[model samples]
Target: MDTLCFHDGNITDLIESRTLDVRYDINHNLQMHSSLIRRLSQERELEGHLGCVNAVAWNSKGSLLISGSDDTRINIWSYSSRELLHSIETGHSANIFCTKFVPETSDELVVSGAGDAEVRLFNLSRLKGRGPEENAISPSGVFQCHSKRVKKLAVEVGNPNVVWSASEDGTLRQHDFREGASCPPGGSSRQECRNVLLDLRCGAKKSLADPPKQSLALKSCDISSTRPHLLLVGGSDAFARLYDRRMLPPLSSCRKKLSPPPCVNYFCPMHLSDHGRSSLHLTHVTFSPNGEEVLLSYSGEHVYLMDVNHAGGSAMQYTSADASKVMSFAPIVNGVELQSSASSGFPSGSLKSNVAATLDKCRKLVQIAEKSLKEGTNYFHGIEACNEVLDGHGRLIGPMLMHECLCIRAALLLKRKWKNDAHMAIRDCHRARRIDSSSFRALYLLSEALSQVSSMIFIVIGYLAIYDWQHDAKMTY
Candidate 1:
């Protein structure tokens, strides 16, 4: 028999997927750190699920661990006994997209969203320790949050009752649990019940496009602790948009609109990379707990970090000099030095030095372009100024130039109604792909530009056909 081995840090444990329900810790570190620790594992291999486990969340007091799956089931596990506590079967008809444990609550309240266009809340406290009872683990309430699949979820750091969700529908919604009563009587309309129990409305007006057909769906979002009411959403857009939740309509129009001022002074749109002709679709976007900076993980092995304060109209970008794929990033608190072999080859000193030099040059070029544009000088001169920066450091500045050029070309085509040029611009985004095929931003932009161009072409053809038919009718008469 081939034995399976499990090893993490100073711990090692193994289990046969098909066998027993026994839970044991082969290593002693968990026992040593018992005050704030727990562990669990999936003993049985769920047969029908198609994908591997994506994420795991622990309830406030670490009592339950909610596991979201591509299998479309949210499995609630008991942390103490490491047993499969409960399985919430409804709410999401498609792949169980995202599951979050609402903070500051003793009740096992888990919120989940799926590809089926719904967000559901399960009050697991009502069914805690009840193994699969007929009604146990079912959703206590549901919110038809988005018109498309919900892809990511985040709970406000300062307030647990406030939750935010991102979806393929191109919208992010904020849910306020403080506004309503919990667990209304059965048979109440889901919409009515949700409106009563949870105030669900679009938190931000920013939208996200779907990823390339060849890539995985967007699955990244994060909230800022330092900047309350500011939510960061990342998707196929390659860029992340930060919105002041307070400015969102419905909520902004509500009585709470007069609440205290928000922590975030202002948020500007920031681009992650300037590479690839196609917009690099970002798989995930995250901010440091301090809200001083942000990071993005794009498809095609690109990971970047940006100082949010420096992300202005001028292009800002950072790439790992050694080129290792950064899957994700967690906050670095205190002065602890946590180094990884992943970034070992890339010297931080050199990387920062190069970035500063490149940014300085780009800034100068931008200033010149702005001056020319403002002075009513030839637009080509401004273009030429930008082109000079692009030519000298194309490899280092290609990503930014591509974005700037696309914006310029897109604006021109939109104004001229030249649908083919816009379509060609998107197709040419493939140039970015050649530089970095895994860039989610490029993939996303290409897809969006393609969609827009396709729609415009269809409408133009329809109008021309109608015009020709009218002309023919007049001649026949």
Candidate 2:
């Protein structure tokens, strides 16, 4: 899908088409289409870019299209007619890499990120429809956030006042439009324009021996539409980190004290070749519109579609391996780490005494199993202990903990190549989903199980065909 290309001025529309059961009216301009529409491409031309267009976005109403280019310019076009409506030279010193139309705003505002390590917001109220490029539309406000180039921008869906920017400086910073406007000209406000800041360096607090200048340059980031507060950041270090809004520091903290390091509650590594731990780069990270799947693009060469519900597993990695290649599924997180994060939302006092004790025992067993799996020592005993904990005390644990345990068991079964045991593992996955329908990791594991079953069926059919061919030759001879 990434190989899809468009000529200068052309826009691609993705639609799904299912015959017989569904119908859509083309006269409605493709908006009132049926749910069956899937990845069908339609093109429209809106040519005004003079250089390589770096970024493009459609407003909430689909009435306006905006593009940012290497020419240090932003162009607005009519979505229906392909006519150039307005062009504004962004007074930035570098090329623009990302742009977004801020949603939930009465005024049409566009936020852009560029090589200057700043995020700028441009107001488009006066120039909605076609006209001569009138008095230039100046940026309403500018956010001097990162020390390096800002690579991506994700607007808070319902909150027009907030915007998030990911940059090469190893940080994800939030820019609040309200703060930029709140400060008086002469006040001592350090966070006058900028908002919350998140540190993306993994384990910097624990790794005292590592160099202070280690590279954690970020390239892409996305906010989950399903969980708007959840943000995902990934890049050169190849670890995709997920942050919860509630875990972030308060706005006042930025003004009064040294900023605390951003806490990353969960992370999964990108499956990229490590040219000695410094070469892999994550080009893009986006959540599926429904927020169940995470699509990760790696250096323009590989696209990995992971089921976020599974907590820790790479479901599919689409590379140059084959046009329709299927990679084996592997779970990423173990029982201990997965459950610890998932269950963190609930308060400690809420659990009964027995329940708390059961949870503790489960955590200890998971830790032992994880160590055994890593060191290849006491492997069978660790697997047995995990199963024992699940059997004896699974019901005592919460939905999130159970989900994590099921994933660990399923992963262990996959490693052992136990076909019959995997059915039980699949059953456990379904049970975990039943426990919590909102669990993204559960859905991921279910999808992987289905895929693994499909692959086995294909292998069986191929083997049968080979056997039949040999039998026929023997009889003929």
Candidate 3:
């Protein structure tokens, strides 16, 4: 913080009139830590998976978390108990890529797709208790259609029978399980059938005259939360294409008669605006919970956020379907000044220019962090950026920047929603409160963090009480 005193006449006159208070207010308002160890503050990594984890999903009420790994195993865990409820050794010979709990199944069924190009189901209802890993247990049902790796799986709300899979063979197919899984007596699981929902190769062909020969391997797919018919399929290209499933060609339409799928909207970053950016492909694309926005992640590139509602020119021009207005959370690794801070009103000292330099540095970092929060995806990276601001500013950061940094971190940690994230967020709030006694944001974040922790604390206390009561009963007997 820079301080300047305005004197109407001379320094002697100003001194005689009054002594400027350098830090009286700040010093008086500064607070101290609680001085107790944060026992509840923690970070946990469930070490159940032997290989790289590829997919995870929460069951209907979010009471259970299921993870699929390259080890060909799936682990079902209870979030409340923080324990593994079941582990299934999927007999697939290849790496599992995508997994999700089937909707409206009461978390009884989970579907997974693997590099073997097969989508299969695991019946959690049959795998009772947290027993040892069951070996070679046959899948409840199987989907055998694609010829390449299955990279993504999507499920529609209120429909347990419909599951969508995207594959490296350039096909997005829908599998129906209702006919087989809801078996009439001892009906065979072979009754399940798969339909070619969207052949990426045929739908991507520009026109009927252009041969549908070129194929791009799909990497991810998602269904909009609000509108079930709106779907997204992202793959080995710079753009993630959105389509309304209702407009897709009929099931009876042969490959020769199928027309190009009319793209609802295109999401691409300005940096990779054209098809020439084939080197940059999307690793993942997902819709916002409210279904008004989309988040696209490019392989080895910064994630981009776009609001589809505000994209340019809804007047359907498929050839130049461009929506490049995107916000990115790219970090400035080098000390690069893309723009001058002259207009930002930061103090500039003619004698010592270091103050202005320092302020600009922290300001840019803070801006990057705030942008990530506003983007509403990749909160972890935002927290990392906020950390750099606090650490790179040395042991004594300016009160203004420190307070801002703390608030940014608190907001990010809360958004991240990782294990014990609330405790850390609460600490950041306290630090911000110490820096600024009248900070409304700090108080607000504290309350939000406390609300999350309160329930968690109650659960922990209940478990402890149960243990104590059981011990007392054993001793009395």
The TM-score leader among the candidates is: 3
Rank list by TM-score: 3, 2, 1
Best model number under lDDT:
3
Instruction: Please give the TM-score that candidate 2 achieves against the real structure.
Output: 0.53
Model 1: per-residue Cα lDDT at residue 85: 61
Any runs in candidate 2 off by more than 4 Å, and if so which? 1-42, 128-132, 181-194, 201-213, 251-277, 311-477
Clashes of each: 18, 10, 0
Q: Write the per-residue lDDT of candidate 2 for residues 1-477, one digit (tens) a residue.
A: 111111110111221111111462233424433322444666765677777998887777788888888887888777787788778777778999998888887537888889987788888785656364563677888777466888898876777888888888666777777656333221235534335466554322111123224556778888887798777777775446566777776543223324334434323322232122344567888888778778777663556667766533335322222212222222335322223232333333534553465567677776766666667665465566567556544445566666677766665654555544444456656556555555676667667776776687688779879999999999999
Worst 10 residues of 2 by lDDT: 1-10
Task: Tell me the tens digit of each residue's lDDT in model 1 across 1-477.
Answer: 001111121221122211111344333334443223335555555332346666577776677778878777777777677777666665467877678987766645678877776778877677644664344455666666355687788886546576676766444556677664243322334433332111222222121222223222335668786886666666654445555666644533221213222223222222223222244466778887578778767666456566766643232432222122221223233522233211112124435565455556665665665555566555555555555454333434445554554344333333333424454445335444443455566666667676776686587679879989999999999
Stretches off by above 4 angstroms in model 3 are 1-42, 134-136, 179-194, 202-213, 252-259, 312-477
Better of 1 and 2 by TM-score: 2
Backbone clashes in model 2, listed as residue pairs: 9-46, 15-38, 16-37, 16-38, 17-37, 17-38, 309-440, 309-441, 310-441, 312-332
TM-score of 1: 0.45
Cα error of candidate 2 at position 402, Å? 29
